[model samples]
Target: MEIGFPNHPRRNLLKEIEWIGKNGFDFVDLFLEEDMATPEKVDVNKTRELLEKYDLGIVGHTAWYMPIGSPVKALRSACIAELKRYFRTFAELGVEYVNIHANWPGGLFTDKEGVKFQIETLKKLVEEAKEFGIKLMLEPLDTRFDTVKNISSILKAIPELYLHLDIGHTSLYGRKPEDFIKKFHARLKHVHLHDNNKSRDLHLPLGCGSIEWEKILKLLKKYYDGTITLEVFSRDRDYVLLARDKLIELWNKL
Candidate 1:
């Protein structure tokens, strides 16, 4: 399994790229925040050049600012516009997969209605993405109360679309990561590998939380060929480095 690190616009991009290369990661997940969402700030051609220099592959994470299933029509439109721009950039960079979050709850659409709308949105996005040879993966988020809790509903709605399973979130919401893997085995494309305490989304390292790594890893190895991005962060750089090291070690053993 190939390992990857997450990149953000707030962080020094070039420095992070160089660091990933030096630290022996195979690829990087470009987390497209609002500032870096446009082609202006992040020149795809230049970014590709750097990745080529480091001999790294890229998988993109879509911007978190706009929710695809927002109740407001204007917000949804804006979100789509940003995503379209991102897709164009991905095409130029030769990036294959773009990870996207599913519809946020509290929208006009009910849980079921939201799923339908999201499926339609994704269907359109996938068609557009095909032109650029990029595939979109829908991610399921864990919520506090009653909401679209897991990926199962979304996956059921859009069977053809790919999946970006966030293992940490799955565990946080009381679902077995292995179960998700087995159930969504066919559509699973990429993964966000992190750990979290039950109470909050802490983004801890693999062994630091309650997730069962060996079982999950064994199940993952059976199906997935995509990068496992360690999505953890803290104010302390040492903590990040330690988590990165531990994840690499675990991946090697698996």
Candidate 2:
């Protein structure tokens, strides 16, 4: 399996790419987010050069806060337009899959209406992705739509969409990571690996949380053999490296 790490959006995009490549990661889960690393701020030509220099692959990650599911028609349209703009940059960077979080509609709509808005917004995105030859992936977040049943509904509506499974998120919403794997393993195109306390999305290193990594890795081995982003968020960069090593060890053992 090819393993990678995400660039903290608040940091320098080119510098993060250099470090990810130099440190022996297979790719960068390039998070195109605000304050610094947005689509407009990214230096695409230089970023591409660095990735090629290290022989790395790429997966596109969008800002999780984008309100694609807002009940307001204008807001949804703006979000879709922004994503389509980002897809052009991803295409230039040789990215194949671009990921977006499941949008939470909040109290503005009922669960059914929220899910409906999400599906309608994503349909436009899927069509836009086709024009750029980039596949779209949906990552279920802690929301009304986080359950497998809701996720299944979205996937059924958009047959061209793929799944981006985040192991940490599964802990937050009373859903186990295994449930998602069992239900949609065939549709999974990308994965995010991080540990959580089963109460919060702490983004801890592999062994620091209550998650049963050995069991999860074993299940993944049976179905998924693609890009996994080590999403350990810590001030200590060593934690990220330690998590990476732990993941590789457990994966090999399984």
Candidate 3:
């Protein structure tokens, strides 16, 4: 399995890429945010040259609050425009997988209507994404939603879609990370590995929280071999490398 990390809020894209290369990471999960690789700010050729220089692979992640299919028409339209630019950037850079959120806030729509609207918007985006040879993974965020939270409900909603499973989010539904791996191993295209206290999204290092990483790592080795981003974060910045080493050590033990 290939293991890597994402950019920090304080750093620039070039600095993050340099760190990934120096630290011997396989690929990078590009978190699209301000001061990072946002739609308008991302330079295509520069991004390509950096990736090539670092010998790195890249996958995209939309910002947590950037909901492209928002229920609000004006905001949703702006988001769609932003995401269209992002998808075009992904294709130009040869990004095969782009993680996207499942739902937006506001309870205006009923469950059935909400799912249908999300599907419609996704299908439209998928049509555009296919032209660039990109597939959008439904990131089932641990939020208040009827259809997109559970693996079973999400699969039934969009059977053709791949999943970008956040390990920490599994705790929100009272499910083990390995359970999703065992059941939907075939459909998981990207993974976000972190830990929490099972009460909130803490983004702690793997073993520092309530997660069972030994069994989780063993299950991961047995069932899946794909890109995993060490999804731990800290303001101190040193925790980034520390967490990466710890996860690698635990992963190696398995």
Candidate 4:
């Protein structure tokens, strides 16, 4: 398995890449959040050179709240354009899998019309990904709106899609990772590892939050053998390192 940490927004990109490589991560999820890794600011040639220098794999994470399924016409159009644009850019940067959230956060979880729009929009995005020769992964948020729990419906609608499971979000939604891992193992390609309570998505480090790590890791080992990203975020970089170590310890059970 390619175990890595998300190069989240902010900080010096080169330094972070250097640190990730020196510290022994397998890859780095290029989290293109606002401000730092936006297509406008990133130099793909230099980025690729650095990644090769470190011998680390790369993945692309679209900005959170990238609502390709919005009901609003203009918003949806902008989202689709952004998705296509990112697909081309990330593929150029050698990102194998590009991830986007299922739906707009803080929107109606039960928005039937919205979900329909999402499926159609994603169909186009998947085709774009195919053109780029990379995979598009859909990540599920905690709420019902555009959730990975709707995996069956989404997959039926767009067969080429894959899943990026966020452990913290699943726990917050009260969904069982074991069940999804077993059922959708074939389509599950990427993962985000972190800790959160039954409440909101805290994005805390492992052991600092509640989760059955051993069981979850075992299920993951049984199915997925691709990239698993540490999504643990904190102002203190050391905190993320600590979380990564804890996750490695639990994952060793497999």
Which one wins on lDDT? 2
Ranking under lDDT, best-scoring first?
2, 4, 3, 1
CA lDDT of each prediction against the hidden true structure: 0.73, 0.90, 0.75, 0.78
**Candidate ordering by TM-score (highest first):** 2, 4, 1, 3
Q: Mind giving the per-residue lDDT tens digits that candidate 1 earns over 1-254?
A: 77888776676666777777777778988876756445657766667778988899888888654566666667666766678888887778788899888765463446766666566667777777778888888777765321234356766666567878888877765666777787777888889887877556778877788788877887788788777888877565566668777766766788
Model 4 lDDT-worst window of ten: 104-113
Models 1 onward score TM values of: 0.89, 0.98, 0.88, 0.92
Q: List the residue pairs that clash in candidate 4.
A: 109-145
Q: Which pairs of residues collide in candidate 3?
A: none
Q: Give the number of the best model, judged by TM-score.
A: 2
Count the clashes in each prediction.
0, 0, 0, 1
| Candidate 4 local lDDT, 1-254, one digit each (tens) | 77888775676666777778887899988887677767777777888888898898988898877777677768877887777777777888888888878774244545566667788788888877888888888887767553444666777688788888888887766677777777778889899988888678888888888888888888788777788888877778798788777777767767
lDDT of 1 at 216: 83
After superposition on all CA atoms, what RMSD does each candidate show versus the true structure?
Answer: 2.4, 1.0, 2.4, 2.0
**Model 2 C-alpha lDDT per residue in residues 33-145, reported as the tens digit of each score:** 89788888999899999999999999999998889889889999999898988999999888899998998677756777777999999999999988999999999886536
What is the Cα-based TM-score of model 2?
Answer: 0.98
Where does candidate 1 clash, by residue pair? Answer: none
